[model samples]
Structure formats: C-alpha cells, structure tokens
Target: MDDAQPITTLSGQIVQMGHLDGSLIERMRHEALTAPAPWKAEYGEFQSGGWWTTSLMNASGDAADVRIADGSARPTTLLQHMPATAGLLACLGLNYMWVRLARLEANAFLWEHRDYDELEQAERHRLHIPLQTNTSAFLVTGGTKVHMDGGRIWRLTPTYAHGVCNLLGPDRIHLIADVYTDDAYARLTKHAQEPTVDERLPTASEADLSEHLATARRLADLGYTAAAEQLLLRLFYSFAMPEGTAYDLIAGLHTALGDAEASKRWTAAKSTLLALAS
Candidate 1:
C-alpha cells in the first residue's frame, strides 16, 4: 500500500495501511503468547454471565489478563513495553504505539460508532501528520477472509460510521497501533508532548464541525439526501463522539431529509436527556 492513497471503508470513511510483512507482526505474536502481562481470552461465553462481545481497558488499564505499565491505561495513553513484535512497529518509527490482540468470534460484530474520547485524543497524536498515520491488519492465520480480508487495517478518520462482522469459525484479532512522530514519541516518553485541552478544543474547532453539519443540511435542503448523508459521515469521522449539539442538528437534518432511522436515534437521545432532567 502506498503511504498516501486514501483507503475507503464499507462505511464511507477513508483510511490507509502499511505493508504487513515486517518484523513487528512477528514480535507482537511472540509477546502475546510469551509475555506475562496478560492473556487474551478466547471468544466464548464468559464464566460469569452474558455474551462476552466487548472488552475494554478500564481507567486503570487492566483487562481480564492485560496490564498497562505505570497504569497508563487511559484510552488515549500510549503503551511502551517492547514486545517481541516491537520491531515491526519500531521499524516504521511508530515508537509511542502499542499492540492489541483482539478476537471477535463467529457472527460477532462491532456496531457502527467511532472510538470513545480517550482513544480519539490519542488519535490526535497521529492526525494530519503524514508519517505517523496508522494502519490495521489485513490478514491472519487459516487463509480465511474473516481472519484476513473481510476486516481491513486502515488509518481512516473513522469517527464516522464503521462496523465489522466475523463470519469465520475462529475469532478475529487485530493488532492496532498508531504512528509516532520523533517529537511526539520524545514528548510522550517525557509525558510532555501530548495534546492539551486547549490544543484539542481548537483543533476540533466548532467551525469545522459546524461546516460539516451545514454541508449536510445544505444537501438536504437541495434534495440530495445521499450526498448529505455522506457529508454527515465526514463530520462523524472528525470526532470520536459527535457532541450532543451535533447530534441534535443531525437528527433534525436527517428528519427533514426523510431519514427516519437517524431521526429515531435523536428522538431517543432527547428522551434520555429529558428523563435525566426530570
């Protein structure tokens, strides 16, 4: 994959990827099996209860078997342990990144939604920085598309709608990481370079965000519903969580555009807000 071509998703966002034959993939796999940090559980019934469809890193960074050093487990925090697969990522100068081995079982899927706040903040570290943009895994063992081609490893601004499904017998695992700039990594190691609230607030300026909403609204006003929906996707990709105000505007726009699905979501959201207020 050329480092610059845009990789589009089934959901309409654009992302990119790196060639996967490097040493980092090997190192990560080695560390996954040999490292003492934590064990990634097989996709199956959880011992304690309902379907185990999603796994998350807590405020402390510890999962069922995973552990983040220094407890820097916040969603946007970079993990720095040198796993056996470190070389692949390091060779690309992605120093502040970490590896995640995820397994999504048969028929299992992730809904269409962007990553949460912290991860979005972490992503800012890679934003618009050419060399540091991230990619995902395109293949896995077993020669299967589910493990391989079905899910793409891309560095897209997917704060827009995106989803995945595992139709294969085995689970789907992804090695997710971000590109690290020399300056960013240096600052990251020192805990001094990450984006601040001031930086993020301005970077994700309301003007740019509003432009997206306005574009969608304009398209709807002109009767170009599909084009408007696509514009809405771009806005969603710009933020992990499109704010309540953004959602409210989207709801009205979609309603006017005759998109009941979107209107229903905003209606429910308003209902929830009303309930909270009452």
Candidate 2:
C-alpha cells in the first residue's frame, strides 16, 4: 500500500510483488515476438529511436495509441491474439487505465526522466512483466541499476527520475500496465519485496566527466550532432550524477562548440526531460 499515492516526485523504489507462470511467460513471449503488432514510435522526446510500444489496452481501443490517457480502457486488436497475456491481465483484476508492450531494441534508451506528469492526477502504479529481455537491458533509478528479471511482476514508481537501456540487447520487450489503485491492487502488491539486482551505480569523477565531454565535443565538431547528443544522454547509465546532469553536459557541449541555438535547445530539453520546475 506504499503505492497508494506517492508523496515524492521520484518513488525511487523497484519492488517485486507476486509472479507469473514460466510456461505462460514463454507463451506470451512467443505471441509478443511473432504477432503482427502495430508498434508505434512514441514518446520521441523521452527515448532513443529504437524504443517502440504497442497498446494491449487503451482508451481508443487501438493498438497504435501508445500514449497514456484517462479512460475506461479496453483491449486493443493486438491483445486479441495474445491469449496468454490477456488471460494473465484478466486474472490480475486491477482497475485498468492502459497496457502496452514496450520493446526496447539493441543500443536503445529511455533517458533519465519522470512519468505520469502529463496525465490527470490519480492514484495509480505501473507493473512490468518482462517477457523477453537480455542481461544488458536494465533500468536505472535512485542512482542504482535494477534488472527486473522474468517470471515476476515488477512495480516501479516511475514518477521518479529514471532511465532504461538495452545496451547490447537483441531486444527487451515488457508488458507494462498502468492501473488505478483498488482492492485488487492491494492483493497483487501485498507481498512486495526488494528487487534482486539492485546495484548502486558507479560514480564518474571530474576527470572521467571531462574526458567524456571532450569525446562529445569531438563528435559534435565532426558533425555528428545527433551522436554527440546521444553520447551525453547515455552518461546517465555510465555514472551517478544528479538528475539532469547529462542534459546540462549536452548544453555545455553545444555551447563549447559555438552553437548557441543548440545549447539553448539542450537547456530546454533538460527542463522538459526531467520535468523540472521552471
């Protein structure tokens, strides 16, 4: 019930509550990989290019509408074919808002950021079921890295600043559901436990940061602007810095390169991505 309503912007906790059947997980994975899903490239500002999502349940009842919104959600066309997933969802019996299959491709990232800020204020939480994932795919939050292994339901209070990466992945796909709090939610999360792979992220010293900044500047000078920006963004995974340091570094990179406009843009990106107060 700690998830009843979060008081802080960043929950900073990854709790493992309950689990799923292994055979059922494999079945769902099969459907997720083989089924013809209308994957949409959404939340462009929050992710690298390869991150994609398809709705299993949404207000519009369409698989292509991946954005979270308020409504009495229903299953999308894509969910119809996924009986195993659908069955699991039904059994959970929580008050639904939306559900989706998020696919993070190799070398992809969901940069350090908060969530649910764009939605109507409500008591809700996100549950993740990792169907297909690799060792290199993990989530970073509270200055720590957590790998939400399969065969379990993982709850992450995404209101906190966090980042996800599929560094060397084949593909990391997960079933993410957003549901309103209710009796069913209490039942599902009653036995919450700490994540198994919560490892504190390593810190980057000033020298390390300077070397990275130099590398980014070099990339930018070579006209690899996008790559340079990505390099800075990826710093979130490599080191433990304050919430928006990567964005700050990016702005500095542009400023050092004499691109005032790009610097200003990255400055704004920092505020937006971190949901920072103006």
Candidate 3:
C-alpha cells in the first residue's frame, strides 16, 4: 500500500457507481450553489473550520438536525427548495437513513475519523454525488487519495479511518446519502466502476513528524494555539501515517503547553473517533 500505484478495490475507499445525466448534474450543481440552505456546523472536533452541512433528509424533518440518527428519514424544508434534487433522489428510490449536502470551503479539512459508529449495528453504506468540487479537494483513505469526480454516484464504507481536505478550493459540495442495503441500492451498485484517480500519499518518516511537531510547538509558543492545532491536524492530508497519529500529536502538543486536561481530551477523542480497543 505504501508503493505509489493505482489502488484497486480496498477498505475505506470510494467505488464509482453509475452515472447521472449531464443536465441533471448541472441542475444539482446550480441548486447546491444557489439554494438557501440551513447550514449547520456539527462535529466541531472532526473538522478544521469551514466544514458545514444541512440535512435534506433525516430522522427529524428539520434541516438543522445534521447530526445523524438511525431512523426512517423524512424530507426537510431545505429539500423543498431543491426540486431537482428532490426529484433525482425520488427517482433512485433507496431506503435512506439520512441525506445531507456537505460543503468544505477553501483550506477546510475533515480530520481522520470513522462514521456510523454510534448508529445501530446494521448493514449501511454512504453514497456521494459530487455536485460542485475543485481539483484541490479530495479524500484520503487506505493511504490513497481519491478525487471523487462528478458525473457518477460513489459508494463508500466509512468504518475505516479516513479524512478529507480542500486545499485551495472554490467550495467543494457533495450530496451525501446514508442508506441501508436493499434491492434498489443493490441494483444501483451492481455495476459500480473503479475510481478514475487513486494516488498514494507520501509516507511520513520520523524526521518529518519531528519537524511538524516542532513547527506546531513554535506556533503555540507564539500564542497561535488554534493555528498550531490545525497544523498538526493537517498532517493527515500531507503524509500517510498510522490511523490516529495526528490526534496523538495534538494531544502531545497540549501536554507540552501545560494543559493536561486538553491533552487528555484529545487522547480520549482519538480513542472514541477511531473506535480503538479500550
């Protein structure tokens, strides 16, 4: 996996599914960028600023209920404004648990974490449709970087550790759907294709880790606490390391700053988010 080569089907990666009409794709894009969404910022620790989401379908019919809950989903008011999106979702016909539009602004990041860990144990999958995205935006999973290109639906199993980033983007937006395994979903993914791009990230050596830690420390000493934390968090995107290395580094940074509670908090977060053995 460390070798620089195109990845095949693997854990925690996106598999390209069937395509959508170009015209429909355009409409989805327009609605994504123009819709009056009730963007909510949840999962604060799982992101590095600028990540927002609005529920289109959820257990509660409120768009602000972006935190996922396992239940029968109902349409939100935001979905009412998006006729094209509603129509498209209706056409596919799957058992949805939740649906949301996630937006990552320029320089934003979603830190490494597993999802659906808190939901009821059942067969579930996440589907993504890239409505608006830039080349600078991509997902890192299984040590491979995948730029989920538009025009097709993509399926992902988020039980494995993964992260996302938009380095220098126009905002990146995608319609994310969480669905249960059913006949319709089986048909939709029966012919799922391979992703177009799968680039392996550069491995981080001991020296690289030391240098980044030192830089973070310098920033912290200069009173740029948030910047220091983000610097360590961003390491996940730049190099391939162990599943929770960045979180460990962040905890270490807090310890060095004489904040024992903060250090403990990050340490606990790593365990919870990665679902590590107690």
Candidate 4:
C-alpha cells in the first residue's frame, strides 16, 4: 500500500476499523457506569426479549426500549448505550435505526444475520447512509481472540456471515446501532467524523490490491494457467508481494509453467523484494 494514499475502496468509502485509544475508552466507561440515572430496562417492538437502559447514557437522544424477561413494560425506548449512543448521534449527523445494549457470557454467540435487506435497486441510486454500525461487547473482557479489548470496534456487515463466541468468564456488553447518514464531511474532517454507511468497505487503493489477489485465485481455480500467469505478472509490479516461504512457492509455480519470461519476472521481483527486506 502507498503510505500517502488514503486507504479506501474503489468507490471512495472510508474504512474505519480499529480500537479506540485506551484512555478514551476508559473515559467513556467511567462516564457511562458512573452516571446518576438508575439503570432501567426498556422494551422493543420487534425483538422478543430485547431491553435497554439509560443509567450509563449521556447522549442526546432518548434511551432504547427493551422487552425484559419479567415482562416489565411492553417496550420503551428509554435505556441507551452511553458512549456509542452519544457518539453516533453527535458526530455522524445520523438518525434512524435501533440501537441496543447487550450482555453475553462465556460460550455466548449471536446467530449471524444481516442488518437490513440489501438496498433496493431504486434506493441504491439514492444517497447512502450508515444504517448499521455496532461496537463489540463491553462487559465481556478477556479471550484468546484477535480483538479482545472491551473497547475494540469492528465494522461488520452481518450479511457476510459473522459470529462471535465468548470464551471468557465475564459477560460481554455491546452497544450496537442502526444508523443512516445525512451529510458528508470534508476529507480533512473525515477522520474526526462518525463512521459512514459504507465505512466497512476497503478503500479504493486497497481494493486494487484485494481485486488483483481475488482474480489470481479465481483464475488459478479455473485451470486457466496462462491467464493467471498474466495477471500475476501485473500484480508483481503493482504490489509489494508477500515474501519468504510464499515467494519460493510462487517462483516454483512460474518455473513449472516453462515460461522463462514469466519465471524471470517473478524471480526478479522476488529479488527486489528480498533486497528491500534486508
């Protein structure tokens, strides 16, 4: 990836998948847990057992409604996720969609499902909005996992078959939101702005890298050796290909093709890559 390039998808969507600074998350946690409001469970219309609270919420909007197990109130949008609720409403210029605060413990997992149905053809042409952006569970703290921090944020599209397992002893708390965008911020403020509807998509420059790799695999799978060879050559020049053991396997494949020219290119590219490594 070019360091100067703003990593984005071919469509110019910004991808913001990362962990918040520890100090920031801690601050948010303190603000949420220490708030004056007593935690109250609210109900939801669509979900069977969904409920939420405002004890920790300091956001502008009203708290979410929840349908607790005790059948307290039918459903009320009273409780809310403090940091996420406030952050989404305040920064992104967003409105609409359900936001939830969830608690899950060890061996817990959410069944995979998409947020909203894919945009209709007509809607596709209209201005897009950030409809689904959810932070990870806050209560569940530890695991032998990729992102275990309570403050870790993952930009996910449930349409893509995502699931989570909580192997830790403590329960996990999540502040998930359904969002839609109303305005666009300038490039300078992009980083400071709320996550966008298309924020999960890879940036334009990174998409080039992704596309090239996908094409190479597809061609190889179809037994189109010659076509794959041609694409691989292009990728060699375009990307800083992976090095070491993977290099030997790639070079051996080219050599097996008996195309001395292709083999030479791969070898040369590998040499350049190794020199840079050194």
Candidate 5:
C-alpha cells in the first residue's frame, strides 16, 4: 500500500457504510437481544457501570483485547455461533482488525474519550451496525449527536474525542468492527455519504468556562475527582473547544485545588493522549 496519500478523515464524525439486508439485520438483532453470551463490563476508570462488550474477532483471538489494534485478526466463538452475522462480515470483504458486540444498558454511558491513541500509526476506522437500539441511544462526536439507524453501517473516526450514551433503552446493541484501510474498504467507502449534523454544540463563553471550572473544582474538593474529570471531559461533546481542551481543563482544576503534582500529571497526559506523531 502507498503511504504517501493521507488517510481521509471525514469532515464530520459519522459516515454511511453501504447497504445491508434488512432481514439480516433483524435476525442479528434478535440473536443479540436473546443470546446468553457473557457480556464483559467496561473496566475503564472514566465510565459508570452498564457498558459491556463481547468479542467476535480480535488480534489476540481473546475476547478481552477490547482496545483498538493494527494487527492480524481472527474470529471467536461468538462470531461462529451467528453464522448469519458472519455472513454479513464476509460480504464487506474488508481487512478487519477487531470485531465485537457492544451493549449499553439503559442509562449507561461511555464517557468522552479518544481511542486508538495507544495503537501504532495506521489507517484504521471503526464501523457500527446497530443491531438493537432505541432513540435514546446515540453517539456524540465532534459536538454533534448522531443516532445510527439500522439498515446501513455507520463509520466513526474515534481518534477524535467522542462518547456514547443510552439514556433510556431496553438495551442498545451494535455489531462493531475495526478495519484497516485496504482496497476493499477504500472501494466500499468511495461513495461515503456526507454526515448530517443533528446538532452542533454551542460555543462556550468565557463566563461559562469559568463557571464550569468552578464546578469541577468543587467536585475535586469533595474528593469526587473522577466525577470532576468526567464533567470537564464531557465538555468536549457540549462545547466547541480545541483538541485536548478537556485535559487542559482537568489540569487547571488540579492547579486551582493546589495539587501541583496532579496538575503536572494531567499536563503530561494531554501530550501523550493527543500527540499526532506516532
């Protein structure tokens, strides 16, 4: 593959993956909703309970490597059990790196975060096929809310900070695939649909920023530091802040609380998390 051409990043967050059979989607949804598969809860420090994932395909052949990757992939029993779903994957003909079924229970949230930051430099993308979802379940990316409707695959460039939420849902489930750029994927996405912005986040005024910082400081003082950090991190989805602004906010919050060491740690994390150069 030629390395000169820069991998295309969508002007907006979501893009359409080509069509899929509606019946297949319905069947997959039924299996997902009824299956007794072991759903592993999300273990990251940033999120609350209710998010779970089970792998269909991954690099280590272990369902637990939920993190993004840039290596060879293999399917797990979860994929084999649903032959129809495996058939759907075969139709795409793309070089997949990882595949999983992610379920978010009612009121669950994947707090604002960036992904693939720890992975090696490569042209990779995340695709979501909503198996079973409700209107309340949606993704916020680039400060725009998107509810990925069924019948078409949805692509998300997750390196940019984004979050998922299921405010009120029976259970939102999606077939998630991470694929590397290849001829098949390039051709499949050649006609990528332009993203429709459901809502654009309003720009925050200086006063608003100050108020938010104060709120975070109060939370930190109360010893709810993680909650404080999440409050600031969520600002990325609510305001049109520059990249890494959330990290900057957390660092500032620590500084205000007279925690120089904590402030310094967050300052360093900002660099490590947002650095574009591999």
Candidate 6:
C-alpha cells in the first residue's frame, strides 16, 4: 500500500466527477429529506449549529464512527432505505470506506479546518455528490469559492484547510463518499478537470489582521468566548495563513484575557489538530 501524502501536496483540491443521472439524484435527495433517522450535529468546537450528518456506509456500520480510514465498508439501515442510492453506489464500483449524507441548514457554517489528519496514512479521497443545494451553499478552498452544482460528482481534498457555508438556504444536502484510491477511482478521475476559481479571497493586510484581533478582544471581553474564537477561526478562510495560525490566534486571545489555562489548552490543541502522523 502506498503511504498517504500530505494534503497540502495534492495537485488540486477540487475535481469534476463527470455527469450523473439527474432523476436518480432527485430520488436520493427526496429520500434523504424525508428520512426520519436522527441527524447527528457536528462537533460544537468545529461548527455552528444546523449542520448534521447520517451515515450510509461506514466502518463497523456504525453511524457514530465518522472518522476516515481503511475499513470494511458496510451499508447502514439508512442505505437500505435508499435503494436507488445503493444502486447508484453499486454502479460506480468504487471502493467506498465511509459514506454519509451531510445537511447544512440555512445560515450554517463549517469553520475552516482540515480533515483526514487523524486517519492512518493511506491513499484515499473524499467525493461529494450534491443532491439538494443552492447558490448560497458553497465551499471555500485555496482562497477560491466553488459552488458544486448537481448533476456531477465533485472531489474535495480535505487535507487542506477549507470551509463550507450555507449562507442562505432552505437546506442543503450532499451525498458524500470517502473512497480508497484504486483503479476505478483513477479511471473515474482520468478526465478530472480543475475547478474554476469562482472568487479569490484577497490577502489580509496587517491592518486587517489588527482590526480582527481587536474585535475578537472586544467580543471576548463581552463574555462571548465562543464567538470570539469563531471570529478568529473565520480568518483562515479569508487569508492564506501558515498552518495552525487560527489556533495560535485563539491561544493568544486566551492569554491576553488572563486565562493562562485556556491559553495552554488551545496551544496544545493546535498541535494535536494539525499533526499528520502515519
């Protein structure tokens, strides 16, 4: 098996997945929207409210084990309920490791962050099939914004810091599949095209950083610690900072607030969160 390469080394963060059946996608979206299964909220530390997920295929068939890794991909009851979706996956013939439905409600935001950092080093990739989405729901990566339209599969290299948001929406849902690198994937992506840069984020000036830092301080002084932390975290999406800069800013925020313990904790978290160990 090949060792997993750092996400930063990937050639491109977004790739096109070719065309898919629109009617089938509609059915999958309808099933997901109507399903009664509980939608698990994302970790409080990572995102704001309104983001939810439910596993379709995962290691051990457990919905709670959302981690990315090499494991026996087993379908959950949720997959059984969406026979059309199962058929679609079967037709693709990709070696799925984890598959899930991700829902982001209106005004939801997934703070800028990286994924697969905690997983064992292996060749894998995350693929997204937009089911029900709107213009407002888009992904920001490499300082560019991309609205993954339906009717095609989109690939996201999550090892790089990226953020997603549904700024205004009824609700956005996507069928996400984590697949191991294999011949099928290689062939499927043989014609993969680079994503067009929809919008480029401007570089943050020193003055801009200073203003943000000062605002964070005010928010912290007002007793909105979470808000303060998030205000700093959003900077990651706006500017190309060195890895772990956001966490460092949060740590500094705590230190200035005289919370030495919190400062130490966030500093430690920066290391643990960004560590890429095999």
Q: What is the TM-score of each candidate against the true structure?
A: 0.39, 0.94, 0.93, 0.36, 0.83, 0.88
Q: Would you give me the overall lDDT of model 4?
A: 0.36
Clashing pairs in 6: none
- Model 1 is weakest, by summed lDDT over 10 consecutive residues, at 138-147
**Global CA lDDT of candidate 3, please?**
0.88
| Tens-place lDDT digits, model 3, residues 1-278 | 12242222355357999989989999988988888888988999788889999999998899989989899998999899899999999999999999999999999999999998888999999999999898999998877788988888999879878889999999999999999999999999999866766887887887998999999999999999889988988888888787788888889999889999999998899988888776
| Clashing residue pairs for model 3 | none
**Candidate number that wins on TM-score, 1 or 2:** 2
- Overall local distance difference test of candidate 6: 0.79
lDDT of 6 by residue, 1-54 (tens): 113221232258887768898899999888888866568875655677888888
- Minimum summed lDDT over a 10-residue window in model 3 is located at 1-10
Per lDDT, the best of the predicted structures is 3
Candidate 1 per-residue lDDT, tens place, 1-278, comes to 01222222222133233334435454554444344444444322111111131112224444343322212223212223433334444444444433354544554434233333233334333221121111231221011111133222344333433334443434444555434346644443342221111111112345665677778888878878656754553332334332333345557787777879978875565334323232
lDDT of 4 by residue, 1-278 (tens): 22443212312221244345566555555544454433444322111122224422223333433221111121123333245445643554434344444444454343211223333222111112222123332111010112224444433332222224344435444454433343432321344322343212223345665566467657766888656644544332223322222234345565655557765765665444333332
Lowest summed-lDDT stretch of 10 residues in model 5? 1-10
Query: Clashes per prediction?
Result: 9, 1, 0, 30, 0, 0
Residue 29 alpha-carbon offset, candidate 1, angstroms: 3.5
Ranked by lDDT, top first? 3, 2, 6, 5, 1, 4
Cα error, residue 181 of model 2, in Å, equals: 0.5
From the highest TM-score down, the ranking of the candidates is 2, 3, 6, 5, 1, 4
Candidate lDDT (C-alpha), each: 0.38, 0.87, 0.88, 0.36, 0.77, 0.79
Q: lDDT of model 5 at residue 148?
A: 85
**Which segments of model 6 are wrong by more than 4 Å?**
1-10, 276-278
Count residue pairs with overlapping backbones in model 5: 0
| Model 4 vs truth, CA RMSD | 16.8
